[model samples]
Target chain A: MDAIDCDVHCAPDSYEALFPHLSEYWRQYITEAGIRVNGLAHAYPRGVGATAPSTYEALADRVLDRRGVRFVILNCLTGFETHRNAYFGAAVASAINDWVREEFLARDEGLRASLVVSTISPEDAVAEIERVGEDRRFVQVLLPVRSDLPWGHKNNHAVFAAARERGLQVALHAWGRAGKAPTPSGFTTTYLEDYVGNQSIAQGQVLSFVSEGVFERFPDLRVVLIECGFAWLPPLLWRFDKDWKGVWREVPWLGRRPSEYVREHFRATTAPAHLPRDPVLLDQLLEMLDGPGMLTYASDYPHEHGDGLAGLLDRLGEEQRRSVMWSTAAELYGLAGNPAASSRA
Target chain B: MSHVEVRSGGAPVTKRGVELVDCDVHAQATEPMLAQYLSAPARRLLERYGRRTPRVTEWYPRARNAGMRVDAWPGKPGHIWGSDPELMRAQLLDEFGIDYAVLEVLSGQDCYDHPDFAAEWNHAINQWQLEEWLSFDPRLRGTIAVPHEYPALAVAEIERRAGDERFVAVLLPASAAEQLGSPKYWPIYEAAAAYGRPVAFHTGGYVDHRGPGYPSYYLEYHVGNGIVMQSQLASMVAGGMFEAVPGLRVVLTECGVAWAAALQWSLDAAWELMRDDHPRLERRPSEYIREHVWFTTQPIEEPDDPKQLVWAIEQAGIGERLLFATDYPHWDFDSPKQALPRVMDASLRRAILCENALELYGLPRERAVP
Candidate 1:
């Protein structure tokens, strides 16, 4: 069985190219300052083996033509990530969504995209979803994980409503913002820390959404936390239920178990699976996590080393392996057209 | 049909063929038991500041459901610290198949009666942690809790307790009266370092003491996990706790994982800007976190994506630093099996369930059953 690295990510074209198609209002904000997550200082430098920022023709050529792979699900850098100026954050989010619809998805049938949105201003994010969600090609809604608060705050329901209206999954990515920054005793940080930080962000985001009854409101609104990893899954589900029982009076609507909601609505991707190659450890993780379907494989292409190789897909049972590769994501993003199996089987 | 049978061996056996090491199991302290080990001065402080005795009980009535009358919440049975030890043992170690349980006690009420009698009060708490908590059960492991006001005394307390085999680590409120893990609190870490014990920075009470800027409510405190998350994690990283004590290891307990990715990235950015400040450090702030820090995830209520958990580990590159913690007896305790999607594969479970924890705490997997 060949490995199908379904979560492989590649950026397409530069911001300048994507900017032209955005609305005049968005174009103004995007032009004034580059994209940036609110508090995160890191920048999305370039895609792996990138030439010309990231181009669709180049991305498709690399992804579809790979000698030994099933597909690469490209996670586009949120258009709003490059610009730190919060004033234009909303406009840039709209423009990024517009670029995906007009250029990448409109021109090619072989591509999938995570539509970027403005996390600061949920209204603009909702507007962006309304504008781009109509396209069948737009499979996911990508929002920066880097914000003063996790994206699940009740105030952000407008964005959730928009995505739910279009049957689109919310793609949570690692990005940072200002105000209420974690730890004021600023110090030098490292890449490894950034990786773990992403997971922490996802944990907070998932908790906020569940505690706020986000799933209860939009049962169909699946929140796929791509690139955050799966190590925390076991403890998170445990802690939420444990804490919820003690504080259930605070959140009246959390009737069902938190995991039940997660099983129904969330999907996570495994790129650069961090643990060492120990069969025993991996086995226990699967048992603890309960299954591989929730742990999809992503190449995170444009980086020096992609997610995994053909050897990995061959390691699991046929059914389990297929779900991680394509079926799970296909169902998640409501991609009725993709060539994935229909049934959970 | 297959039944899990331990065939006369000393290795853990399970249905999925996996063992677990819970890094953050908690223990409850009884006033009498903890008071026994306290000195005259410490004992008085506990009776005074810890309990704030001669007190009036105020009730904020709440309804369990709609149309119900509001009443003071006594909380669930065994809600704070279940009276039974065997029950805790089975739930934390046996049920989850965990081998080690890093026990953090239920911290007493705070902000009032602090600063003046601080060390004495903390000594009382630490005495209970070591005396009553250490022997709660075979699975229970304990840490020394200290009063943050007296950093030097807190350090001294840690040094005294570090030699005990039962004492696994030291606990500090990431937010007491002041932001924790800051340079101001380096003495606490220094004491931890002297004993080769790790610092378990647990989150609580920051909402009451600090300005979280959120409306008062249970959800606000619980949901705004970042109130402590921001100050503690950020303070540790930015304050160069890692730099101050290169050999020191920091632990984050019951704090959610959502802010970690951004916080770490922001720190790395800050690391560049504040190069002159932390001139003694060899690497970036995130580097110390990757190497020396560990976090516990329980009641993982947020984020539906199981892979994002892995992504987070990868992002932090602290897989070794991650420990599967169940804040048992408290609100967010989790069953190992119930924590993750039942479909997760075996290899991933092994790392999250046991190996990672064993490596993190440097513990031997007891040959209880195979």
Candidate 2:
């Protein structure tokens, strides 16, 4: 099967790896400040096998060749999205984008990358998107799923506008902003809670996007949720559609059912399948979720979410499997019929 | 007017031969009613603020009739919707042949910044429910409303009401200052468990209600009910609170049901990958959830295709744990007849509508159709 791996992660080998990409001032600022990117330690921990490839050869060896994926979208999260200092965050984000381009995209024919942006400042995010979004190899703009404010807030609209203007889809990958509490209540006491809470945060973002009129404003925008599970979508959308009927007047800009907008606008990576162990129930869930239309295949390489994918694949029909594994993401990222695009770039 | 004649429009709900137990029926508390029970200092605060304290601002304005059904208002000019117990009995208990209606009084007192005031106000609300609503009807039951932020006071309130059979559970807001499973809240759980009353976390609180921040619209806030519930559930499972208080049982009310199955899967899968993160957990995360938690089906997920709902319930693997609720008087009330899918199995329907709640709350199984 020719699969499009929608979410494969990469990171700088070390802080020094980003030095050449960063401006001289930022390089000095980081070194003098003794700053470090903790690799989103709260989420990825230290030794639970969530190590991302620091180079293109490693990613290709691990995901492309081993997994036989036709294409892989490289998501390089430098942990700068949650950085407290806005200016420093912006500089680090720019460096991460450059590093992703020069190291990953420039090396492999099967590689495409997401432009890293500082979520703290929409103006800087837009500037970063405009700078690298024009690169055809850069197919989407990457934002962390966890943010100080939801991406749908009007304040962040410019970042979406910039991505859409440059014909880039937005990918909200899981694990972000360690400084911020993972749950609505407050901080979690364990990593298990913080990690599982990512899906809940993803749910919040989806509601934010639909209810805050982000979809209405950017009709053509497509947002893919990477590393976040998709099985939860059916129920969330069901509630969303029902509540919108009762409260549509509050968000008057919406012209259709919230589920309809979500179905049209959103796609989710299938790494953390979050599927029932029962085959019958898994089939039922896929049917409820319109799996063929909404799910995109991803290895979420180096993050060891269990072997639920085999069960998901077994439950899917041949055509539906093809759609989930390849076509849905191809259409979502405009990679269909463009086999040579990555090579040419 | 006869009880059956005044039912809000829908097919007859009590046709099935099972008892109907509404797990979530709101009994709105008015300022004057609650102030009557408070101490002088708290009473003065209540009188001065009039239930609209700076801490309890309505950031997410509900869409219709202040989040209540227009017809739910009592005929009296100044009476609030769902305030008059006779009207509630006529509309909900008698109308639908409900054997037991567990009253959830969201007094807005829990959000008070002043701990002393919050504790006093919540205590007053509990007293108000006992005298004004629960005592008014034989079918009604009470929840011990608590100032959850101040766990010591919450524990005290639970202990004070421990002997009351009319009060079936302890009520805590789903959104709180910290996740309900934290050590700070263990004392409240201890008190509730000591008395054999399950703690019910209903949706609504002063917390921002989203991990990110306040959402732009009430629709988002409405959708956030499930999100916050999932967070709390994950917190409880991971914080080892279930291990800390083995007798603790939780009922998540008015937070949609379908998300539970998905959260279970996510928790189990993540626990597999990250088991070492929390060495305190003796079993898989889902095990604790299945053993300890119950869910209420109010504002039930009504998918476009009813069969999809059947699939969701099956996926949730919690038919025995499902508790049926109407969220009566709220604008998005789920009618007993139409809330669930018609395609559901007869046995499952029995469990959801009556048997499950009976097992959870230890209510009498006799059909009390007035």
Candidate 3:
């Protein structure tokens, strides 16, 4: 069976690496301003235990090659979120996309990437999508999980519209130096606080998308929530389903149950697979989430300490394993059958 | 302590020697009482502006009784369910056989945006609890409603109220401008810790910045309350508030139980990989939650399987952490006898209904049935 690794981060070492891809104006501005690379605070410091193995060769060999991944979607985590300035964000995103394309995807036949877009301006995001989205290797449009507004709000419709127009999935990955705390609440004192709080943001974004009628607005758009643990999803959806019954009129555009739309329009990548001590509870949780069809395999490559694909496969039933390991992602990313399929064969 | 007339239909205590303590019974004061406590400027502004509280929408629909039990209405044209002390006692404490009921007042003024108003309203409400409610009923324990945005003022209130053991906890709105874990709110935590008072975070009053955004209806707002609580819990755990104030205990009043289980698992998972991000955390995040946090059993998550509920409670370590709450006079009040599974252990039932809460609040146990 061909396996599709849905989430794998390919971070650039420095701005110098993307200097060729960046326009002269940005290069000069960055140099003159003495702006450090990525200009964003990393929750995990480099050379620390949490830092993923950095080299592209190491990622390919350790994750894709070792795991027998037929295809892998590269999600580049750079300081693109530092670009509150529209021009700067767009330039950083463009350079990162170009850097990933040339330095990684081109070299690996099995590699694919999410077209990174600076969402400071939907117009810029759409334009960037229009520019780089046509590339067949780019399977999705990557936006950081921390956005100014819920991604479902109409303000974000342009990015989703552009992605759907290009036959691309929109993936929300964890990165971006959030202007406020990752949660609705203001800043926390520590990085751990922000990290655990990411789940709330992911859950809120999903609720925002469903409640705001994002699916009804664009039926073709699919959202993949990456790095957010999936155990909390069942409860959130259950609550949304219960609440939507009474408030459906508020969002009259939503024609079905919130959970129904969730099952239809959303895909989740398994990285930090939060396994409860009781394995039975984990099984029941997945059953509640309708996991066979919703979960996708992801290593969060080089990020030290995620539930590896092998560990997850061991826990799931055969049917669930198949879906989580490859099929669900392949079907979602629209890679059911492609040239890469032959590599596994 | 003052004496009160005992009424029937008191919330029952199923286990013998377990005197029932309702974790979340509300007490409310009329508008005139609130006006008296306000500063001259606030009172003048209140009269002129007609009590401005930030709301996302003009209308918030509630079922008959305004999302209170259909029968809980005081029958007075002007009164909501918990506003009438007599009605609250008869409907919640007497009928349910509750030995004690902690009061959580929801006046819509708790989350007042202006620092002066929020502080004054909280002070007034806490005062109202003292004069009108606690003085009227010894069975009733009061909470100091602290204005979370102004930590200095909030800490001062906690300091003032610390002498009164009747005031068992400090109540902060579930929804706040800053999450409970943010260092900005730590002064309140510090005060509570110094005084050995648990911080009770009750749902509502946090409409300004809801986790998902403002809702169209009250049902969404009501169910979404737990989501807000979850975020606050994460903030507290991740923000290292527990580390900063080691003696502090957080009681999640209106938030449901199951999410804590999920958070425990998820936090532990995240910590395993990202422990370096928070070097101050001496132990796993879940360990901090287990030791420092207590969740109320109102809006208890009703999973399809009866066993799943127990499984979740046990999985979250809430068997020890869960506090039985009726959310009395509200729409979804859980009758203690029926709220939990029939198969629950007698010890566990007693712990949730009476013992755990008594221990956390440092209330002396009344081992004999009253």
Candidate 4:
């Protein structure tokens, strides 16, 4: 079976690595500002500990070749989402996309990319998508999960429309630059609170998409929640379904239960996949989610977790494993006919 | 073809008969009536500036129900459902056969910018509960609402009310200016612990105090409540609130228990990575959660299959930690009998519906005279 790593991350080796990707204007500005580096530190405090020895080349060698991965979608978190200046946000996102292309995708045909965009200006974001949409190597349009408005709000529809036009899935990764506070309550004091709170932001955005009828508006548009824990998905959908039954009149366009929209239009990555205290319960949680069909594999590289796919794969049945490992992502990025769908089996 | 069960008022009873103790039952004060209980200065502040809580944007305008169940509004022209204790009794306590229901008023006391005024306003609301709601029915109990900004006064209120068995716990807004974990809030936790009362977090406060920022819509606001609780849980544990107040217990109301399982995992991992930061923590953070934390089940999360509720309960190890609540007069009230999964185990159902809440509130086990 061909496995797909939907959320493998790589950071710029240095800020200067993006110098070539930036315009002369941004280059001069960044140089003058001495904005020396890009890492998770810009989003939150840095401490992923245990950096994996494997870079993209080694991932191609070890995971793609050895672990039977046909495709690896590279996600770069850095400061792309956190940059406050709209133009700088666009520049940083563009630079990261370009850096990922030259550093990872150019070397490995199996690798794919996300056109990271700044949502500070939807027009700029749409323009960024248009610039990068033609590159078949880029499988999705990426934005930070936290934004000024919920993902379903009309403010974000322009981004979705642009992504839909290109046949690109929209990926909302957890660490976006903070729009206000990381949560509705206010800013968190600790990184631990911030990290755990990211899942809550993801849940709100998912609710927005379902309640606002974003999927109904853009039927072909798909959303993949990256690094947001999937355990919340089953319960969240269930809660939304019940709430919608009582409040559907508020949003008449919603044709069915919130979970129905979720099952069809949305997909999630299993990076920091929670292992319920009862391992059997984890299997059952997936069952409530209609099995692993809605889930795609993600290794969330450089983040420390003892078990990734091995932990989940051991509990899942064969069909569920096949779906989670490759086929689901294969269809998601429209990679079915491409070499990304090739199999060892 | 389709098999589903629907009941008008609530669910039909099953054989393992045990009455429930609802941990979260809201009672709103009728406007001018609560003003009567307030001190003169606080009353003037209320009349002049209204609530001074920071306002953030909320995009989804509340439905005509005002984000409440349509049927919840009291039939009378001016009054809302939660405003009248007699109506609340007929609808919630009597309908569900709840033996004991904790009365937490949505006073908007936490919204006040001035600590003294907030303290007085919350005190008046608590007094209004005793005079208005709790006096109406013995089955109804009250929680001392304290202005979190004024810790000494908050503790004094807890100490003042601790004498009355009718007041079983102290209520604080989940999203506060400072996390409930901070040293500033510890005095309040200390008082609750001293009184052998749990500090309960009922959702909703100043829109600005809510973490992240204002949610664009009410639906986003609703879902985001769980996020606020998760942050508080993490902050309280990692920031060493439990370690500081050894006897304190925390009840997370409205925030569903199912989310706790995922949170427990995150907490455990973070503690392992940053154990040194919390030198006082004796065991893993999840252990503190299971031991000290209790979750009320309203807006109770329902998976597609009935068994997933049991799975979530099992995952959180909160069969005993879960307390049943209706969140009376609110939009998403869970009918005690019908709300839980149909296939739930008799023992587990009994535990969630009654025994757990009794143990948490230090209430007696005897059934109410029906």
Which model scores highest in DockQ? 2
lDDT, model 3, position B315: 72
Ranking by DockQ: 2, 3, 4, 1
Candidate 4: lDDT of A38?
43
Candidate 3 docking class: acceptable
Off by over 4 Å in 4: A42-46, A50-66, A79-82, A178-180, A336-345, B1-18, B54-60, B69-79, B209-214, B273-280, B367-370
Candidate 4 per-residue lDDT, tens place, A1-345, comes to 678788877777566778898899988887788775645563434455533322566666545665576778887776554457888888888887877777777887777878888767888889889988778888888877877667778777988998888878899888675546776556666666677667777887888888778988998888999887777777777767766777677778888888888989888888767565466776776677777878898877657543545777888878888889888888888665357453221
Best by lDDT: 2
For candidate 3, the iRMS in Å is: 3.1
The digit string of per-residue lDDT tens for model 4 on B253-352 reads 8977777877787677666665555577778888989899999899888776778788878887888888888888887778877888888998988888
Q: Considering only chain B, report the TM-score of each candidate against the true chain B.
A: 0.78, 0.92, 0.90, 0.90
Alpha carbon lDDT at B248, candidate 1 = 87
lDDT of 3 by residue, A245-331 (tens): 545666678788878898898888877677675667766666666565788878776665455445556667777778787778777
Stretches off by above 4 angstroms in model 2 are A79-82, A336-345, B1-18, B49-57, B367-370
Model 4 lDDT at residue A64: 62
B171-226: candidate 3 lDDT, tens digit per residue: 88886766678788888888898899998988776454433344444545556677
Interface RMSD of each: 7.9, 1.3, 3.1, 2.5
lDDT of 3 at B176: 71
Q: Which is the better candidate, 1 or 2, if ranked by TM-score?
A: 2
Listed per candidate, the RMSD to the true structure in angstroms reads: 10.9, 4.6, 4.9, 6.0
| lDDT against true structure, model 1 | 0.58
How does residue A185 of candidate 2 score in lDDT?
A: 68
